[model samples]
Target: IKDFLIKNKITFIEDETNNNEKFTRNRIRKNIIPVLNASIAGGLGKFKRFFENTDSVLMLFDFLIEDRLNIMKSKNPIILDISKILYYNNKLRKNLLYYILSKNLFVDSSLIESIDRVISSKRPNIIFKEKGMIIEKSYNDLKIEREAGDEFDKEDFLKPGMETLFNGYTLKITKTVFIESLLKKKNVFVFPLSAGRRFKIRTLQTSDSFVPFGMNKEKKVSRFLMDNKISLSERRRVPLILNEKDEILAVGSLRRTGLYRMKKQKGCLCIYVGKN
Candidate 1:
C-alpha cells in the first residue's frame, strides 16, 4: 500500500503523536517490537498472521453470542445461565465479561477475580463493588448494575406467560407442560399448581420464611440468605416473589419456597433468572 502510494505520488500526512514514546502504544512499538523482531524468528509476521485469522475468530464469537440470545426465554435484563458461561475457558470468560459490561464507560480487568470467586462459590448475592458498579451472582446469572442515585425500591406484578425486569434481574414466569418425576424443589415447577397463578415481586420482608422442597420446614429469609453468603447490604436489596395469598414462593433467584411436592402434574412454571 505504501509502495503504491509512493509510485502514484499520493500525498499523506503522518500523525505526529504516533512517534511520541510518551504514549504506551508508541513506547511499545519503539522499545518492545524491535527487540522481538530482532530476537525471534517471524515475530513481526506472527502478529500480522494472527490478525489475518481474526475474522474467523470474530465470526465464531458472534455465533456463540447469538446462540445464547436465541435461547433466552425472557429479556430486559437479559439474564444468562451461569453454567453456560463457566463452561468456557478463562479467555472466553474474560471476553464474555467484557461483552456483559460493554455498556459501561470502561471495563475494569480487576473484575475478573471477583466474578470468578462469585461464580465458583455456593454463595449468592455477593456484590463486587466498584466505582458506581455493583456485580453479583443472582442465582446462576451474573448480574451487573451501576449504583443508583436513589434507593432501588420498586414492585411489579407478574402473571403467567409474562416476563419483566426487577431490581437488576430479568424475571420470566413461563407455564409449560409439567411432568412430575417426584424430584423436589427444581427450578422448573408447576404453575398455579406449584407457584400459583399470579406473583408480586418486591423487596425482601422481615417475616418471610422459605420452605425448602420436600423438607416441609420454613427458614427465615434473612438467615437463609446469610447462610448462602449474601452480604448484609445485598440482602436488603434482594427481591422476594410472593404469591397472591402473600406467601413466599421465591427469594428472588436465591431460593424457591418449595412447600408443595408434585406427584403428577399436567403443566409446569419455569422461572428463568438472569442479570441486566
Candidate 2:
C-alpha cells in the first residue's frame, strides 16, 4: 500500500505515533513485521489477509443480528424481550449488547451475570446497572433506561380517578368494577383522598407495618418489600398510602391494608390503582 501510494503521487502525512515503541501497534510494525519478512510462513500479506477475513465474518454477524433483533422504544425503559436476547450464546450476547449500546458507553461484565441469574431463576423485577443505566428484568421483558436525572415526586396523594406522574410511570387511581376481576383484584383498596391531610401517599418508612388485606398478621414494610423481590432502588420509590394516624393502607403494587377492602360489603367505594 505504501509503494502504491508513492507511485500514484497520493500525498499523505505519516502519524509519527506509529514509531512510538510504547504503543502495541507501533511495536508490531517496527519489530514483528520486520521479523516476519525473513520467515517463510509469516509475512505482512498473510496478516492483512487474515484481518480481511475477520472483517468479512464480522459483517456477516452484523447482518444476522439485524434480522433477528429489534428494540421497542415506546416503553419508558426501551424493552428487549428475553426470547430475542437469549437466542444468542454467551459470545453473541456480548456482541449484541455492544452493538445495541454502541461503543460510546461501557457495559460492565456484571450485566451478563444479571441476565444469567434472571434466566436461571425466572425471577421478576431483577435490577442491574449497565454503563450507569438501569437494566431491569421482569420475567421475559428486559427494560433498559438511563438513570433519572431529576427526583420523582417526593409525595403524591390523589383521589380515585386522579393521576400523578411520578418517576418514570404515571400512577392513577380509578373507581371501577374491580379491573382485575372482582375475585382477583388483590392490590385494590379504598382510601378516601377527601380526608385531605388525614390521607396521604408517601415513601415507606423502616418502622411501617400493616396487616395486608385479608391477612391477620401485620408485616414490616421492609420485610414485605424484600419478600416481594422489589429491588432496593425501586423500594425507595414505592409509595405507602397512609391514614392520619399513620396506618399503612397500600404499599404500591404490593398488598394494601384490609381496613377498606370490599369483602362482602354490598355498597362501598373501591379503588383500583393502574400504572403505565
TM-scores, all candidates, are 0.42, 0.38
Q: For residues 1-276, could you state the per-residue lDDT of candidate 2 as single tens digits?
A: 879899999998888886776565675466445645444145556656645765444554443444323433333435666766665456656656655543212345666555455644556668876544677778777776665645654564555434454554445554333223544555455543332233456776778888887788888988989998999998888877766677776788667776654444433334444454
lDDT minimum window of 10 residues, candidate 2 = 67-76
Off by over 4 Å in 1: 1-149, 180-194
Q: How far is candidate 1 from the true structure (C-alpha RMSD, Å)?
A: 16.7
The positional error of residue 22 in candidate 2, measured at the CA in angstroms, is: 86
**In candidate 1, how many Å is residue 184 off?**
10
Per residue, candidate 1 scores C-alpha lDDT tens digits across 220-268 of 8888888899998888777787788888877766666666544456756
Question: Could you say which candidate leads in TM-score?
Answer: 1
| Residue pairs in clash, model 2 | none
45: Cα error in model 1, Å: 64
Instruction: Give lDDT for model 2.
Output: 0.59
